[model samples]
Target: MSSQPSCSQTTPSSATQSIRPVSIKQLQTLGGASGDDDAL
Candidate 1:
């Protein structure tokens, strides 16, 4: 009598961490391993 589906999931250390600071036009649109494409 147990089909299974009830874990509820919320455990990455209670999840909520984003100090948010990534701008140089968003790291040049993040396409080249993001170091502003190796300073072009």
Candidate 2:
């Protein structure tokens, strides 16, 4: 697999921009339902 950090794992600012347009719930799904601190 490629050794790349996911969008969610990127810097908060970058992640926010890259994930822009995606709803919080959608982000949460991509982030998973474990309630990870970075879900938001």
Candidate 3:
């Protein structure tokens, strides 16, 4: 809700740009989270 508007202020595309890389990094950090997806 409030957080969405905060990150999206600069550009509509910035929302995806900000989230995708960080989301991948977070999953990688979480260990088998990403690995499990790859294995499947």
Candidate 4:
């Protein structure tokens, strides 16, 4: 029972770790584009 819960917890964390970087990179790209437009 304890092991099951640990496994479940780890699964979501690993999934999020994979997704979070892609999301951050996309946001950074969009922010940079907007910032450049604002500067001009």
Best by TM-score: 4
Model 4 segments more than 4 A misplaced: 27-40
Clashes of 1: 0
TM-scores for every predicted model: 0.17, 0.26, 0.45, 0.53
Error of 4 at 29 (Å): 5.9
lDDT tens digits, residues 1-40, model 4?
Answer: 9999999999999999999999999999999999999999
Off by over 4 Å in 1: 1-32, 36-38
Best model per lDDT: 4
TM-score attained by model 4: 0.53
> Count of backbone clashes for each model?
0, 0, 0, 0
| Residue 7 C-alpha lDDT in model 4 | 100
Candidate 1's residue-wise lDDT over 1-40, tens digit each? 1323222233332342221234544555775565666886
Better structure of 1 and 2 per TM-score: 2
lDDT of 3 by residue, 1-40 (tens): 9887876786768777999999988877877766777889
> In model 4, how many backbone clashes occur?
0
lDDT of each: 0.44, 0.67, 0.81, 0.98
Alpha carbon lDDT of residue 1, candidate 4? Answer: 92
User: Against the true structure, candidate 3 has what lDDT?
Assistant: 0.81
Candidate 3 or 1, higher TM-score: 3
When 2 and 4 are scored with TM-score, the better candidate is: 4
